[model samples]
Target: MADEPKTPVPESPPAPAVAKKAAAAKPAATAAAAGNDAKLAGRTTTAAARRPKKAPADDDTSPLMGRRGWMGLAWGAFTAANAGCLAATGRFMFPNVLNEPPQQFTVGFPDDYGIGVDERFKDTQGVWIVRTESDYTHEAPGFYALFSICTHLGCTPNWLSAENKFKCPCHGSGFRPTGINFEGPAPRPLERTRIALAEDGQILVDKGQKFQEELGGWADQDSFLQT
Candidate 1:
């Protein structure tokens, strides 16, 4: 009778209540994880919003902000200021004034001039003092001044010591020692400047007052001074 082999025992199945509890706990865990992820995303968004933004590289609000531009501007200002100062200094040093030579000027005493044509005043006064024979033979000799300007075109003539005459370079005009034009396109003789005796007995030459030889003004008493 060994009998009938004992029947093998069957394994017990899991309880439905336990399975339900585990499934519910799985849903709770998934919701908790989703909430944590949402919190992290919110923190990340807040941090990004709080961060400071970077500025642009080429912020050219003003020209002086750039290195090269600032240097150039500064240099230009400096140069302009220096130029203004230099101009001001020049104006101060040389003020606006009439610098023309006086029309009436004094030479030296009458005794200083000699009996011959004096070239001393040729460069400075543009005149030649010529002591010639008196028109009145009995009277003392008189002095006359001959201008060096050319009669034609009003050009200045140069005295040629070798030729004993005045030659104009502009038109090749020639003049004698007595200011008489001998050659070239000279219309007439060189004119004479007026001369007078000052209160101090000094010789005064008035360039404004002229004497024309054709007009016989040279024979006037004021034209010649008695030596």
Candidate 2:
């Protein structure tokens, strides 16, 4: 018998059926692959969580002791102290100006005094106010101020009413009621200060401007003011 006739096997299913089965198998495979990827990602996340964390580093920065911070503070303090010292020195060197009384002062009215020597200003002003007659007849009267300072050593001479003269307690210098040095080491007569009348009817005495009989200053019209 010759080779049995090869029975042609039934033809495989159509390509469409095969394609459909393949498509169905592809979905299951893709599901399995996605599950495996999800598991791997979960494992990686667990490993990261199990790792030990690193310790924090120590901080070395200081707030006040920084390089320029402290240095700038010290410099500022030094400059402020120096400035205060300079200001104090300047104030001491050139102090504030003051207005003091002048050498000329008011001694009140002429009628306030008596006829003879007025010793009211002796201890206070170092001067004596004397109202005397120009002549022995006692007709023409004039007023004069006699400096109480002794001519010998610039000491104050006390008026001795008992002795009728002015006597120095320091050098024994004596002066008459008219301010004439009669005894002791006094070289000249006592000096007289300038006198003037103020607009307010007060007697103005200028102690800075004095008249000395030895220097012919008594002839000056400013030596005394006419009442």
Candidate 3:
């Protein structure tokens, strides 16, 4: 017995259509994920490229000096060496010379001296002006300039007024006031220098001309000044 008629049920979509839609959604999601991954990779590559590269720890480069600094040091050394060489050359070119006193000079007038040994010119002129009443070698009353140098070794002899002699301090050589060597190692009498009157009336002594008693040079007219 059919009591009532049953309601008709709605038909579901086809499995193929559902399957196609799901398949299309899956492909779109996969494509979106791939695009994001590609963007991230690109960003990472850009950042890495922008970063600076670091030098190796084993590098031999010096922090304090560069190539220019080394070159400057070499140039400075070269210049200093050249300067030293130039100085040596200059010293060789201009040799040293001795400065000696003039050979010819003039001492004062004859009236300024008295009889006996006058030591005024001993230290300065290297001569002793002796005014003798009678010279032993010349045998006359006049003035004679005796060289203060000893004949033995060229040492200077001092005049001792108390002893009335010229004594050589080096070897005990002795000479009378008349310039005659009497004791010690002296080979001859004290030599005399050229003595004359200048045009101005002042006595002029010339050390350039020497007179030796042994050689009869003391007999020369220039060796003695007759008062």
Candidate 4:
């Protein structure tokens, strides 16, 4: 058999070299992508770390008064209101009372007083015991109690021994020893209280029974005590 003429085989181009280059470029691209992802993850972490945190609620971080403090203040106000109401109720239940002196009282005996104005009971009993040799209106020797109040404006009169008169410091009203108005703004004579002798010989003065000279009440027998 004659040798067949051999055809020249074409040499394949460097496919392995091209494939290796492609493989190497793919790995580089993957590495570049990985680096970009790593950089993005780092940026995200930094941004998250830099962001501000949220604040607590108002009840937990209030600037003025805490929740417990506000509650305590409300309770204190309620207690004070209750106390005030209780005080008002108590005041309504029990009212105020005024203590006044007795209207009837006893002085000393007739012999203890001289034949002049006795001012011993003036400050304490609001009366002046006058023992007279003869009364101007009754025309008899007796003892009478004159109220120490002035007839002008109800002011207390001071007995002046040197002047022999009752002088009111308020309006300068003057009264005689017998309680007769003598000078200054007195509308009428002084009033007389009931004078009597007690069972024990003491002078019993009853302020509840009053006698006015202008009203002719001095003529009553109870207005004077005969010594």
Candidate RMSDs in Å, in order, are: 13.5, 21.4, 15.6, 15.8
Which pairs in model 4 have colliding backbones?
none
lDDT of 4 by residue, 25-83 (tens): 99899999999888787356767789999888565576888889988999999999999
Clash counts per candidate, in order, are 0, 0, 0, 0
Worst 10 residues of 3 by lDDT: 54-63
Model 4 Cα displacement at 172 (Å)?
A: 2.6
C-alpha lDDT of residue 44 in model 4: 62
Model 1 C-alpha lDDT per residue in residues 126-165, reported as the tens digit of each score: 8877766653321567676788788899788887878988
Instruction: Give all TM-scores, in the order shown.
Output: 0.57, 0.57, 0.66, 0.69
Query: Which one wins on lDDT?
Result: 4
Q: Residue-wise lDDT of candidate 3 within 1-227, one digit each (tens)?
A: 86798899999999999999999999899999999888787356766888999875543387888767888999999999999999999999986987877666677887787889999889988999989888776788888899999999999999999999999999999998878899999999999999888899887888999999899998899999887
Best by TM-score: 4
Clashing residue pairs in candidate 1 (N, C-alpha, C atoms within 3 angstroms): none
lDDT of each: 0.79, 0.81, 0.88, 0.91
Regarding TM-score, does 3 or 4 come out ahead? 4
Cα-based lDDT at residue 214, candidate 2: 85
Cα TM-score of candidate 2 = 0.57
lDDT at 199, model 4 = 93
Q: What is the Å distance of residue 163 in model 3 from its true position?
A: 1.6
Q: Against the correct fold, how does model 3 do in TM-score?
A: 0.66
| Candidate 2 residue runs with Cα over 4 Å from true position | 1-88, 96-101, 135-140
